[model samples]
Target: MRRESPHAGPLRALFRQFSAFAGVGLVAAVAHYGALIGLVEGAGASPVPATLAGYVLGGVVSYALNRRYAFDSDRPHREATWRFATVAGVGFVLTGLFMGLFNGRLGLPYLPAQVLTTGVVLLWSFSANRFWTFRP
Candidate 1:
């Protein structure tokens, strides 16, 4: 029988965790977009503010789903909630900056700019949640 490499186990586990995280992200993204569209198209809200609200909704969904499904975190709610919120607060700042840059400065449509912002925030959220917030 062949022996497995030590790194292989860790890398595979990381991949699995990331995959689960992405799955949860999809659900959160829906909540984000729904709020975005509803506020922007329905209520005539500005793109930046609309996205800010949507981001909050998405963050709520992300926290709940990611804790139970993606990271399967056992960190007590008191600790985990703060850590998750910290990570999300940073993500929120990033989201606003990117939105301002892409949609406001560059004049990209709101949806497209948001897509780009989401990509950048996704990497940060996954890393922080996996290593800091959810780490056992």
Candidate 2:
């Protein structure tokens, strides 16, 4: 049998976790953008409020999925939920700021601004959740 590298197992595990995280994030993004679009287009709601609502829905979906799949933490639901909400709360503020800057101040389209904001928030979520919210 061939010898495997010492670092391979941990690397593979990390990759798997990241893949799961990304998958969950994709689902969350669908929820977020769907609500945003529906509220803004169908209900004629303003972008900021619509985005906030969408983020809340998406944050719920993300917390459930990430806790179960991505991080696979055995932490109690109460603790994990509180930690996840804290991170998400900060993320929401950042999202609003970025969206306001990109869409409102910069005069970019809402869709593009939201897309950019999502990317930025994705990084923040992954880092914060990995380090604090779902720490192993």
Candidate 3:
């Protein structure tokens, strides 16, 4: 057994960062799903496009919250914003690809597919944002 201290500095920091990030993600997800459901059920938009739109809305929210809340980054906006967008662009593509696979091909319902997609994207987004977008 290789047990280690519970309060190890780096490990604890990572856990705290991820916890804050997940909290912000929840708020961002509301914006995302709100747009998705509204467009799909109310406006008759297809799930894919609706979700894409929602992803954009959520990305904006995520960036705003995550910079300070999750990462406590002191990076200037001029630099950080572009890095954030770059990471988000990759996430957007992943979102579309996974959504298509899950819903369009696998025949899962749109909401379920979105939930899966969110989990996948969350890992990518957190890593990229932590290492690149908001690095201190």
Model 1 TM-score relative to the real fold: 0.94
Worst 10 residues of 2 by lDDT: 127-136
Better of 1 and 2 by TM-score: 1
TM-score of each: 0.94, 0.92, 0.95
Q: For residue 14, what is the lDDT in candidate 1?
A: 86
Off by over 4 Å in 3: 1-7
Q: What is the C-alpha lDDT profile of model 3 across 17-121, one tens digit per residue?
A: 999999999999999999999999999999999999999999999999999899998999999999999999999999999999999999999999999999999
lDDT of each: 0.94, 0.92, 0.96
lDDT of 2 by residue, 14-118 (tens): 889889988999999999999999999999988878898999999989999999999999988889889999999999999899999998899888899999999
Please identify which of the two predictions, 1 or 3, would achieve the higher lDDT against the true structure: 3
Q: Report clashes for each candidate as comma-separated counts.
A: 0, 0, 0
Clash pairs, model 3 backbone: none
Candidate 1 Cα errors over 4 Å, as ranges: 1-5
**TM-score rank, highest first?**
3, 1, 2
lDDT of 1 by residue, 1-136 (tens): 9999989988998899899999999999999999999999999999988998999999999999999988898999999999999999999999999999999999999999999999999999999999999888
